[model samples]
Target: MKSNQTYAITLVEYAYGPAFSNAMVYSGYYEMTGTTAVEYVIGVIEGPSGILLVDCGYDPQHEVAGRESRAQNHIKYQHPTKVLKKAGFNPEDVSGILLTHLHWDHADCLECFPNAKIYVQKDELFGWIETLSMPKEYNTLKVSVDICDIKECINALGEDRLVLLDGSVEDLFPGIDITVAPNGHSWAGSLITVNTKDGKYTFTGDTAYVKDNILGGRHDGVSMPNGYNCGSVKNVLITMQDILRLAQGDMNKVLISHDIGVWDCFESITTPEDDLRIAYVAK
Candidate 1:
């Protein structure tokens, strides 16, 4: 018989970024006026063994490539260590990290968690490494590769702290399983599905930017893909459909990492100042 275990998942907002409305939705026509800024978050899974972090939020000083130009007006960043502490977790307490991809914002803070082993899709790591080896100008024009962040991951691998996945769905802890996104937002993004008292929750890292990306379509019951897809748009649509199917059609179970609306669905904790907030804590 299969053992029934449950874990609690929390969404910790560490940074904020601008998102274009027209870019987020799928429409044949383009409207370049309105934009909605969204939050950058990391998922925390608390289980029987220990705490597992989905993605490490970017370090405030990493100088996110294109973001620098608009940094003054569009970006608001916080160090992951401080953010995790505010959420009641110490950086060193994280037992493992389930990286969706090797993007700078998601993987740059790996060094903060000294005791945790990092988990990533094998293809994602190799593809990123190969891209990094290309001529700087060519790779910069073709891809959003962050050499510094990639080097940090490489150092972790050298230290025997990296765990590579062969693109298979497997249990990371008692009630948490990691599933591969058909074609990643980047190369090979991964999703974390956790069984909680409420239901099954899948942390979709950039695969689906917002809830609408998975539910919005031309037809009433169809699903759509996000505007930004580095891999394949076709794969984005297929991945959205798969996530909905895995959630058994319950949209609430599909937790989107960058959706600000997520705060409304969960019980959130925030200070009176309202500048910081932690969403979805088990009561």
Candidate 2:
């Protein structure tokens, strides 16, 4: 079924930093050396329904405190609102936010859009809640999540602004649909596909970090999984295969939110102040 509406998609780069090569690809240390520059991004979809965000970028206000960090070198951080405003869009007018997953980097900034309804996989929420409840020895499992973000979701639930999905949903909004890949990158990772004026583009959250994960970089014809997986590596493979199938074998149609290479594939404009970018995927 096709929606009567089509959107103009934009990829917003709010922050960036160096990421370990191995963190991007499983056992990448063997063949990959040095850190690769990566960006933290969010997807912006504009259509007749309203301005919708794929995933909210991380919140600077809650940066991991008092810790010597390895991946904490992220810079040029800007709230989605400020970034959107600098790019000539009204941040306050956001109507909804489709959370691909609840990793702190993706969902911590939800408070920025107070009036927007949040759509997330119910299993994603439940999975995190269950994991967070485990003993401190299981802390490794909780590394990528923020308790505050979960609290914020709970608050949204109380405010009637959270829409939890049991699984996948088509036409969540006109020209927009959500696909949940249970136990993929994170505990219940998911991706959103936008049928836009140009074509259908899939905004893959953290499920597939670099093209190598989907396009087979390890060997001539094999897809490699990212290094970190809160779920299982086997599930990661399944999710990526599903992503490739959804893209219909066209790697160009899949937008890897963290990959720096995305800017090269699309026409992107950088904001003057923060040096953030907005890539027009469809317009």
Candidate 3:
């Protein structure tokens, strides 16, 4: 049986990255002029156990190799600790951290939370290891990943702070379950579902970048795949069907971490001093 408890989830924006080209966001969107600014966020899940985070924002001080250089307009608004405080919690208060994938933007800041146990998909790590083992000519396959970050995750495992799930998990923590979209966005993208007072809200971290990928393609009764990914497009569409099933065709119930439109669609609070915004997923 699944846990009946509910949690309050909030999304905290820590920084804003470079604008994403349309082709990079929407599959088959070949237009070059159209672009959209994306928000880098961390999902805060508060429940009976304590505060848990969906993905920790990256560390600006140590820019990892292979990551695209931040442009002049790229903003590092606030450190994760300060931003979390502005959002009403301390870094130390985070009891667990759920990583959607090991991309630099998502998993590089795990060290910030001293007391939290980190959870990641087992295959996500192995897939990167396999990529890293490939020949030099295949380097493009891992441009978005940071070897240092992967090493840090391995170190956490050695220290007993990391839990690698083989596949989808139920009641990972009370009211919080995890579902994987393997070979979709990354090696294994973990889509999180948190039960709330109103209903269940699913946090999609790169699995579905925008509304169209999950909600569009309705005429064909299938999902639209993102243009940018590290895996097969066919598998991406297949994985999206799982996300769509979880959402039950309701776009409002899906929380897309990278989409700025989420802020417009939900009740949000912005702290100018910290230069961060919090979108309430469930009150």
**C-alpha positional error of residue 34 in candidate 2 after TM-score superposition, expressed in Å:** 2.3
lDDT of 2 by residue, 96-214 (tens): 98998988778888888888898889999999999999999999888778888899899999999999988888888877888888887887766788887777889888877778767
Model 3 scores a TM of 0.92
User: Taking the tens digit of each residue's C-alpha lDDT, what string does model 1 give over 1-283?
Assistant: 3336888888888777666465544432233456656777888888885888988877646666445425424355567788789889998899989998777667878889988888998888877777667685755422445667677777888999888888756566667777787554777888778888887888788876667667664346555565545677778777777788778888888888777888898899774443667897453
Which pairs clash inside model 2?
Answer: none
Q: Pick the candidate with the highest TM-score.
A: 2
The per-model lDDT (C-alpha) reads: 0.73, 0.80, 0.80
Total clashes, candidate 2?
A: 0
Name the 10 consecutive residues with the lowest summed lDDT in model 2.
63-72
For each of the candidates, give the backbone clash count.
0, 0, 0
Pairs of residues clashing in candidate 3? none
lDDT of 3: 0.80
> lDDT by residue for model 3 over 17-49, one digit each (tens)?
567766667766434467767788899988897
